[model samples]
Target: MTPLLNYIVSHTKLPEVSIKNTVELLNEDCTIPFISRYRKERTGNLDEVQIGDIVKFKEQFETLEKRKAAILKALEEQDALTSELKQKIEATQDLTTLEDLYLPFKKSRKTKAETARQNGLEPLAKIIMSQNVNDVESVAYKYVKGEIKSVEDALEGARHIISEWINELTDIRNNIRQQLERFAMISTKVVKAKADDENAQKFRDYFEWEEALSRIPSHRLLAILRAESEGFIKVKIEIDDEKALTKIEDRIMRSNNDCTEQIQIAIQDAYKRLLLPSLSNEALQNAKTKADEAAISVFAKNLKQLLLGSPLGEKRVLAIDPGFRTGCKVVCLDAQGGLLYNETIYPHPPKSDTIGAMKKISSLTEAYQIEAIAIGNGTASRETEAVIRKIHFKNDIQVFVVSEAGASIYSASKIARDEFPNYDVTVRGSVSIGRRLQDPLAELVKIDAKSIGVGQYQHDVDQTKLKKELDVVVESCVNAVGVNLNTASTSLLSYVSGIGPKLAENIVAYRDENGAFTSRNEVKKVPRLGGKAFEQGAAFLRIKEAKNPLDDSAVHPESYAIVEKMAKDLGKHVTDLIGNKDQLQNIDLKKYCTETVGLPTLQDIINELEKPGLDIREQAKVFTFNQNIKTINDLREGQLLPGIVNNITNFGCFVDVGIKESGLIHVSNLSDSFVKDVNEHVSLHQQVIVKVLDVDVPRKRIQLKLHK
Candidate 1:
């Protein structure tokens, strides 16, 4: 096996066969979700995350190999390549170690040390480094040249060169890097000019903060860095200088003599002028990268929860984008989320056309046969809800307050424009509110996940990494909840495993030109959708009235024969075997296992039979906030109120209690006992009850404790 593959196998802990096959598949353009789901037998049933890890490591290893080749070429050109050094370069897999080994050889701009070396002070520096004599001042006089004058000048030049040499020692760099990682402290101070700036108050908690760099939470680190970026604060990282000096001394000082004193001077100069700032910056950057990863990971998880939020399956919905001066924009949607009609109602004060607005709402509710009303949780939502509550509808319609995050962006997007060319942004937005209640995953896929507002400091993180991870989350959620072949929008269909943006458009175009997909097999006829694409995407695309009932199930088409055989053995039709829990339980899964299909595949097939086309997410339920609480001022300490988790970070989760300001539920209050992970106790969009702990109206902050 190749060394790269072996390394990947060792790290990922998958069998070498699985790693090799997955790498080959990835090279051929197979997607992670597709490889993990459809190629179970080939991949040894590795999940999405494992396959993603393999792909990442493979790319990184390839990059390292390329860098090694470039360095080798450069070394050869410079006539500095030797058998031992060449072997060391080739053997090194870590980028940091390779760079360290290359440091002394790197072409650098002329500095004091370079000037000293150019003036023939190297011999004197070496003689002093040996520490064989104490009268190094007289020894230094022999190298007197154009730039060298007094004995002190010669000694100073020698010390500068010696300091540069000490700074480049790989051992020194490595040991110091370890110290920085273990003991560095990150401290921040307010920029005095901006101390009273209104924009800077948000960072006041961090204006004078100091904490162990190694132990600082990712959110706090990001917050401090952001404050520094905005010129509201200045930040630095430091380690105990005594400890650092002791470590550097042990590495460089081999003897105790007058020369040792000279070396000690060089050591202090090396650290003070060169190593501390350089190493501290490197350490801070490394920490920031890790912090970004942790923040991005939390954002990705929250996005997944928000995207896969419980969908209230297709119901005729009346949606309202609440407002005050402009009146609440309302739209009625059909069960398929098609906009049927729209209007405006000024139910609240400013116009206070309550009698007229209520009459209009009641007539529209009866006319559209509305089963539910989705109200945008934005300005004037509570007032609008009160208006809706007073209406005597013809039917018992459920009322829901939907988060309006990113709905505006989607409304003004190209996709939304194409979907509703004649409608305004308001109408388009209200339709999104209605569709979210119907199928959040399907509708949310249309908008950028970052704009969805579930992320914490998403804009500050490495955007490329954030985008990649969020795409993975979206794809995972979309594939986990199989899409309906007949009705899924192009945006929704785009995230289904192997089918990406291009294929999604092609499928939608084909469906538009033709008609609703009659069977899973018909997807193959879409332009550019070849055999491989069909194989990867077929199971995740459901056709409700297909000729074969298994088409609606997650069981792959290649495995249908086995399922059919199992049903035959039980003397029942495929339809009859599906969803019959007792009948499915009686059949032995082991009987269907084959050379290619293992217990994992068999179990998946059996599970699909029990709940065909089942959504893995929960059902969305209506939540009500306290009528008396309008804003932070209305909140009283110790009052229990209903809220929904809006965003989560490493430190805590933000809960929205139907107010302009969100409350922070610190990790300490997430549970009655110690909570290591806040997600274990709360999730994005989860309906929770919280007790008001404190309210700082001036700061516009609310502290809440979860009702354990």
Candidate 2:
């Protein structure tokens, strides 16, 4: 293995052998989630996060190697490659250092130095470098040619060469980079012309803002950049130019003479023409990249939590898309979340057909045997909920106010169209709400993760990076909670480790044509599914009605022989030993310790057998809002109310308190001690109580403090 891989393995604290095997697997087109799950013996039981680190470091190492090779090839063609220079290049580990070493020899456009060298003034430049205190101008008179008419011209040409020399000096560039990184500050000023505009109000807080580039928060940096992009503000990143100039001069000037003045001139020209612009741009880009990564990490974590939120599980549900003048559209769904019926009810506003809407709801509830009612938390939601709560039904029904953040988007999506080709968008939206309550992970993966409204500054961050991180998060969550092979939709199955969109479609088609998957081995029978794909996807796919009970669990097909042997030794069927804790305790794990199967895999098998298809998520609980306060105006200071955390961000979380506005629970208000992270206190969709600290009815702002 290369030294780069060794460094990476040491830095990430992963075993060298495991990292070697993981890199080989990744090079062979293995996915991260797949390697972490089915290839645990190969990766030494590394989780998805560690495997991702390995992938990142491996890519970076390969990029550096490629860059060094290209640099060496370029130097060789220029005939500038020497043994000493090549040794220095080979010793370099960082791209910045290597690029700095190559700058002086790099081919470029015809600049001032190139023009001077063409006029035979390079000899004068060399003479000037001697730092002679006398006759510097006299020496300048010796070199005269085209474009070098006078002594001053000769001196100017010499200064241009010296300036280029100073600019390309690796030490000077590195020192300047260090200074800019440590001392530069970002400043912003609002454009006065657009200050009074309505659309510009969102950026007013950033006007006249100044902060150290190193210490600025990620969200604030993104906000400043967005404002500047919209022509609403002017932003600058800089340091004290006088201080930075002195640092550069100290590196270039060794002695004082007439040559010192000339060198001083070169230093000034280099600082303004080459150093400041290049270094400032680099600093800004590096800071921007750091900020983008921070924002993406926050977004990814929030998306993961949101995707894995509490689920109501399999149950018949009645879902409503509440509205006012357009009327409320309702749909009834079976336990498996298939749409059974749909209708529109005018229970509020212009029509107010309370009797007719009530009759339809009651009749549908009895006809469909509905166990719960999911009402969209939108316009006329409170009234619709009140009407439902008053209804008298033979079966008691639980009411839920599901967030309708991305329901419209999902309704108009192609997936929804394919599922319900005959129904309109409203019915699709209602069914989405019901399914969200039934299985959050299954339904949320169908829509783009960015549209879920769970992140901060998601639109402003780097789109490609954000998409990659969020996709990884989704993949981790999907594989962590095993997929139901028999009933999973194509959209849900697409996130399985080895299954892409095409393979998911194939799985669904196969199930439709060939009946349910009777064994984990049946996945390979699907058209185009090869051995590698089956190996990666088998452990995460569950077949509840399979002949062998191990097929229904997370045990891989490769390890089924070990489980069967354990059952045989215990004198019981595999099904009898599956959940029998007493029988499971009697087996010795050391007996299963083969070259590939260790304690980790064996323990995982034991856990899975103990609780086959266990769900790490909690059951969805019904929440209640304060009855007296339905809008911001009714909220009084010091009044205690229950709320659900709908969104999390760097600053704090936004809690939905059953109103049009979501209250801000700042991080400071989370605990009596210091709350470092808001998520540490509450997660997405978690219930909490808060004290009304302040309320702005006109502005629709509410500040809340944690009560419990």
Cα RMSD (angstroms) for every candidate in the order listed: 2.4, 2.2
236-294: candidate 1 lDDT, tens digit per residue: 89899999899988877777877988889999999988888889999998998999999
* TM-score against native, each model: 0.94, 0.95
- Cα deviation at 664, candidate 1, in Å, is 1.5
For lDDT, the strongest prediction is: 1
Best by TM-score: 2
lDDT of 2 by residue, 114-181 (tens): 88988998888887877865779888887876788999999998889888888898888888788888
Q: Which residue runs does candidate 1 get wrong by more than 4 Å?
A: 14-21, 115-124, 133-157, 255-262, 568-572, 588-591
Error of 1 at 282 (Å): 1.7
lDDT of 1: 0.89
Residue 540, model 1, lDDT: 90
TM for candidate 2 is 0.95
**Which pairs clash in model 1?**
none
